[model samples]
Target chain A: MWRKLLTRNEFYVALVVVGLCLVIGAVNPVFFTVGNLFDLVRNSVVMGIFSLGVLIVIISGGIDISFAAVAAFAMFVTAKILVPFHFQGTILVPFALSALIGTLLGLINAVLISQFRLPTMIVTLGTMSAFRGFMLAFIGAMEITNLPPAMIAFSRSFLVTIKQGRFTYGLHVSILILIVLAVLVWFILNKTMLGRGIYALGGDRSAAERAGFNIRRIQLFIYCFVGFLAGIGGIVHSALVRTARPFDLVGTEMSVIAAVVLGGARITGGKGSVVGTMLGVVLVVIMNTSLILLGVSSFWQRAVLGLLIIIGTGIPAYQATRRRRAA
Target chain B: MKQIAWRAILPKDTNVRWLLVITVLVFVSMSLLRPTMFFTLDNFSSMAFQFPEFGLLAMAIMLTLLSGGIDLSIVGVANLSGILAALVLTRLLPAEASALQVVLYSLLALATSLVTGLTCGLINGLLIAVVGITPILATLGTMELFTGIAIVITKGAAVFGFPELITFMGNGSLWIFPVPFLIFVVAAAVFAIILNKTAFGAKLQLLGTNPVAARFSGLNNTKLLLQTYMLSGFLAALSGIVVLARTNSAKADYGSSYTLQAVLIAVLGGVNPAGGFGRVGGLVLAILTLQFLSSGFSMLRFSNFFKEFIWGAVLLVVMVINYLTNTRRERREALLQAKECEVNAQAD
Candidate 1:
């Protein structure tokens, strides 16, 4: 029976994760409320954006532990650029600068990994620290708090509302951005030759090379795309909070990677979906919110989350082994 | 004489030799930048004392890599176990216990820490070997799990005020060298013996090099994996104890930085991430180089961010060089094989 369940790619695990979320929500009535639900969605949007970038890297058979650092750097640059040019017509400068810095950082990672043929894990590990250091040196020990009211208003503006005061919850602009990006990613992954090329390279690089895929170009593009997404996320995050702090997103890579893996992407690379990844982000957000509602200790929340990840990933592992044995 | 000269010109392994030369150059440059401050005996002692904790972690990482796996939970395990030890020695043990009783208590703490590490390792091995999760994902999950447990246990506080004997290992030195430093040296020697001179070591290398081949040859890959992770856990726990003793406190977040540092050392020491090849001596040299650089940076009063940056940069450079050299050698061999085939075809 277990072997039968294991044969399908990630079907059982997905069902289990959804089932667990429902069970937790049932235990706490507040978890199912509109306000809490919207909060969960908001949380997912924040992590999902970053996880989407991580998903691209993992699908390409490379890992980037430096995404958080890139985001932090983006935040710093955006804040610095925006604060000085607070003149009536200059918000675009910070936006462009942040995105550009993120792309450049991503390009550096791409060059080091693809051109040098270096290990992704080690290279990103290095840049993670280097980028963070650059941010610290540039920003000093100060936090940027003078965000433009325009940016804040844009972030908070409701894109859609399901009304009746107590039951009313609205979609923020950030969620719309997340959805748009997710759709774009889905299209690229499924429609374009470059998208197919990424999967091919990840599945088996030599085979992909033999089939005429430009491996270096694909890798470079993926890293840059990841960096771009992280940059956008950074800008959105700072705008939402209305402040940019240097140490704001420390140790955030773990959650983003966790979300991507939970979405059924292999850490070893070549398999993942944007829809599944979005679901993963939602699952984590739901779990955290529900746990809080259930009055569980905040610290125990971390352990529980960790256990969920282990069990979530462990089921697929067990199924794979069982299949290998049967074969 | 001619063979020696040729060997000097073409070192047995260019990457390893290059790393050695680079390490020496870094040390020299650091010494030159702040000659008096960097070379002082007091600074040397302080640096030497702090080296053992990270050094042991590096060794633990090397062992795991040799077994063809990586353990991301080492940092979490070390922190958890160190905190446990501090709690036991300071709060749990009877105040008026005799010397033998105190020794027994310490032994118990050590055993408990080791067992904690073993259990975590068991979970990792079972997930990877039996359950079939990849090492990266399995360890990543456990890294969160273990660290979370530490936080839950301590509520993010540090455990302080251990007995004198326990603190002595961290603070007290034998003549000029710290006791923790001695412990590191002893641990390194023992690990070297286990890795290089034992039958178990041979099997580990075989398993790392080619799992399918090793299994077909009748090696118990599963059991070997379990043992390797368990050993890694034990060493990490030990390092935690040393760190706790040295600092006179055990924080739930201690050794948070060692996770990447250990991997950095393992790779720099010439351990192949793909597994199957590495040397203990290289790891030792890598640890020394890192420690030397870190101490130098601290002496120069570099900010925490810059220190971390330099550490990461050095790791990147070392790994890049290692990867390039290995790939270049493989390409050369492939070319040679192709040439030989072409010549044989001509003759045919």
Candidate 2:
């Protein structure tokens, strides 16, 4: 029964998450409190969105270290356009602009990789630096702190609430957005022909081409999708914090990739799920919060996250080895 | 007539020729942009010194790429080893040690760093080769693992105050060239030999060309994989020692930028990501070109942002060119084979 349970990917991920949460809750009851849980979910939402974008690329058998740079670029562009035009009152304007910029950047990545037949890793690596340079040049290390109060309130508003005398819990707007995206992505990945084609291409490019799939178009779409997700994530992150700092997301891509890979996505592609990614995001957020609540050394937290990434990927890797041996 | 056609169209080993052309073009452009400074020995010497640290990293990246793998943990290994060397030399060494003693200590530091790299490489190799994790994912995990350990050990602090001999290795000049530059030449020569002359080198090339075929032919895939990673780790560690010696300080994040930069160097050098076709001579030229470009930007007083922009733009352009050239060659070969097949069929 145990072996059978371990074979199901989602089952194993769910079990591990629940087990960790329970252990943490047991150690510190505060970890289970309504207020704490809500805060945890809210904090995880923006990062979750970014991870979702990375998941698209990973699923397509590519990797993008440029996501964080693109996110920072979007945030800078949003701030520059909104602040200069005095359109900060209209949250939709900056949000849409950021998303547009992100999509455009993604399209550039797609064109270079697909059209030029360049390696995805090298192309994105170059863009990461390029985008970061653009951001630094545009912003000049400026911080946009004077966001409209309405925008702040909208960002901070609770979308769902439950009250108990002297205690309350609620889901933030960010969490709502994350749930909506998760659902949409799940639908697209599982129910669409394009999604299946993506899997086919990632599985084996030559075979997919032989089967009459347009490899170039699918790759372009994948990169653009990741860019769009990153844009949305950047806007949401800036809104939640009520300020735009151009350097806010440095080193964030590492964490996002770790979460996605840990959740059971194969880096070589053709294997991943939105549901699995969601759980992976939750696991990482919980680990961070639990470490803080337990008063573990801040230094050790990074170490723990690193260890989790290794072990998480190692599990499936080990399983694959065993299966190959048995065969 | 055939020889002329081959010279114009094929240019036997065009990759090497192209690399040389690019290097010369970059140098000429730099000289034009900064006429007085670009050709000066002082400027060249400084540039030479600054480049070997990155050169070492490029070498590490080249080895792993040749073996049909990638090592994301190189920068992290470099950071860990360099920081450890800094800490020991500053905190543990006696102040009155002779020059020879200091040199001995530096060598010891390098050996320790190589060992650290070996261990990390072993873990990465075992995961990818034996455990069946893909190269990128396995190294990505180890990248985090090794870097995290570095952070934990140092708590995000920088270490400094190495012995003068160690510092001299990084900063001192021997005649007209920097000590580090000399070390780089020696290391590169040794590596070039190991990669081109040895049986192990041939096996690595075979592994990169076709792992399954190599395995079917009775090659010990696992052992070769392990050795390749070990070599990468050793070089990374050596880079760390050089880095520590040069800067006179060791920070936990010393080599963070190298992770992607090394990949860029390798790819720009014509090392195919799919593996099995590259040469050290091309890689060496590519590294010099990149270093000159960056150094020229600084000499021209370009802003940090502009320098970064130029680096990215150059990297992208070079990569696109390399990709197009390879694809064209592949198509030409395929067409030739098709014509050969058609001729045979008609005869039959």
Candidate 3:
């Protein structure tokens, strides 16, 4: 049992995450504080949500760089459409509306990929530009500071608050959304027939088709689901940040993809886990935000993260090779 | 008879033929729309100056795609190379330096950028070819790594203070053609020759077509991959020099949008993203076509965002058309083979 566990990629990744945490905690005990933990949880919300959507795509033998643009379009357009109505209602309304927009956009990708048989990366690249351009050109490029009341109120709402001296750090309600979505994604990926279809397709598309899986339907579902999640992530991001910007989330594809890959998700597809992905998200978020506690400058943070991703991926790969040689 | 003549006039490659059609359509429409502004030599000259950096980037990406790999790091490598070259120029050249010293230092700066690009490519090659990481992931990591190094070097600031000689290369004209355009033409010719005539290009394509087959054939897959990535780096570095010369400055974040745009141009040029097929002629035609469209759009007073939207629409439309044509061709070939087999069976 121990040997079996030792060979698993997730074990090593989890170990690395914990090792990184202990190192940071040792360097600065303040990293162990409740407020810091709360802040970390809050920071992970948007990125974690993005990672979930990306993880699904990666597991299905494809990559989607357009999620960032899709999220931006959904979030920005939702904000723009809401601006004139002044319809101040529950946060659910905007969330639902954004999700609807995202699903429609994602459907475009699904149709192009499934029906036309275009390459996923190329299609997403085109769509990424199209969506971003549409948002900036037709929708609007201005940052909307005047968000609906529910969004502003939701930003202030917290599931948990910790008072630390003069400052109080509250775990935002967005974290709850992330947790619920993560669990839902885990269930979808593990407990559903559609999930099995996704795995089979990723493992080998021809074999999956031979096995009677509807490749087109599964692809449609996967992309649309991703779009839906991206919409949720977008709305959550705007609510948490208290503003919507057309350019927001455009450059986050690389880090999110890296985090997903680092989480034991194979870029070649057919392997990944939600728990592992969450751990990867924590590792990436720490590498991004908490390096200051270790006295590393902000400019150097990206370098460190890059090195960590390379090392993180390299170790597991080396082990797999060695194991294969032994076998 | 008409179809045969049509085929005779057009290139044998479907992608080249399609690109030619698009080029003619864009040129004629733009010329007709803005007869004075679009048809002028000056407009064409200015576009020639503007497109080389972007064209070089597209070629850099096209090379990687031909090897069945993608280099997301080209933009990062370009920026890093430019920043390094910019640093060499600013730090080494003494104030009020002689014109001779200026020319010499500029050459040194160009060399530095090339070297930086080579080293960056070597790192990417090692990670991908040796470490067994996916090309996308390896390049993505190196993209950040190279860009991070640039950021650390510049502290997220643009590097300036290039001497006049280099700036002149960016902005100057030789005869009727811009200097950058000349450089682009020369580079394109060399790439065309190397890809069409050389053993390396043949092996690289074979490697891309099937890595396992290449390995079984006793080809050094690792060496070919390394060379391919290194060449990509070399091209990216050359593009960096062009950018530095043209803009007279270098920054860590310059041309962040070029990464995606380069992929678009490369794919539109008939470079298969899955690997093992592309042409220099197609890529040049793609670049020219896009440039004309961009210049025309600007002349029409359309917003920059609309250009992006149009590019996306064009890419999707081209992809759909290509897909239909490919399927039709495949079906026809299959049918012909079936008919031949039936005839043989009747004879038997």
Ranking by TM-score: 3, 2, 1
Per-residue lDDT of candidate 3, residues A1-327 (tens digit): 999998777888789888988999999999999988888998899899999999999999999999999999999999988978896888889999999999999999999999998999999999988888877878788899999999999999988787779998887788889989999999999999999998888899999999999999999998998899999999999988899988889899999999999999999889998988998999899999889999888999778877887887877766665675579
Candidate 2 C-alpha error for residue B161, in Å: 0.9
Where does candidate 1 clash, by residue pair? none
Q: Give every collision pair in model 2.
A: none
lDDT-based ranking: 3, 2, 1
* B1-348: candidate 2 lDDT, tens digit per residue: 887986875325677678778889989999999989988888899888888888988988988888888888898888887877776777667788887878887777767777887887788888878888778777877787787788888898988888777888899988888999999999999998998899899999999999999999899999999999888888888888889888888887776777777887887787877777778887888889888888887888867777666667777887777678889999999999999999999999
- Assess candidate 3 and give its TM-score to the true structure: 0.97
For model 1, state the Cα shift of residue B325 in Å.
4.2
C-alpha lDDT of residue A185 in model 1: 90
lDDT of 1 by residue, B94-211 (tens): 9889999899888887777878878887888888888888888888888889889999999988888877788898999999988998999899999989988999999999999999
* CA displacement after TM-score superposition, residue A151 of candidate 1 (Å): 2.2
DockQ for each numbered candidate: 0.66, 0.63, 0.72
* Model 3 regions lying over 4 Å from their true place: A321-327, B1-6
**Relative to the true structure, how large is the alpha-carbon lDDT of every model?**
0.82, 0.83, 0.91
For model 1, what is the error of residue B241's alpha carbon versus the real structure, in angstroms, after optimal superposition? 0.7
Residue B269 Cα positional deviation in candidate 1, in Å, after optimal superposition: 2.1
Chain B vs. true chain B: TM-score for each candidate?
0.91, 0.91, 0.97
lDDT of 2: 0.83
Selected candidate, larger TM-score, 1 vs 3: 3
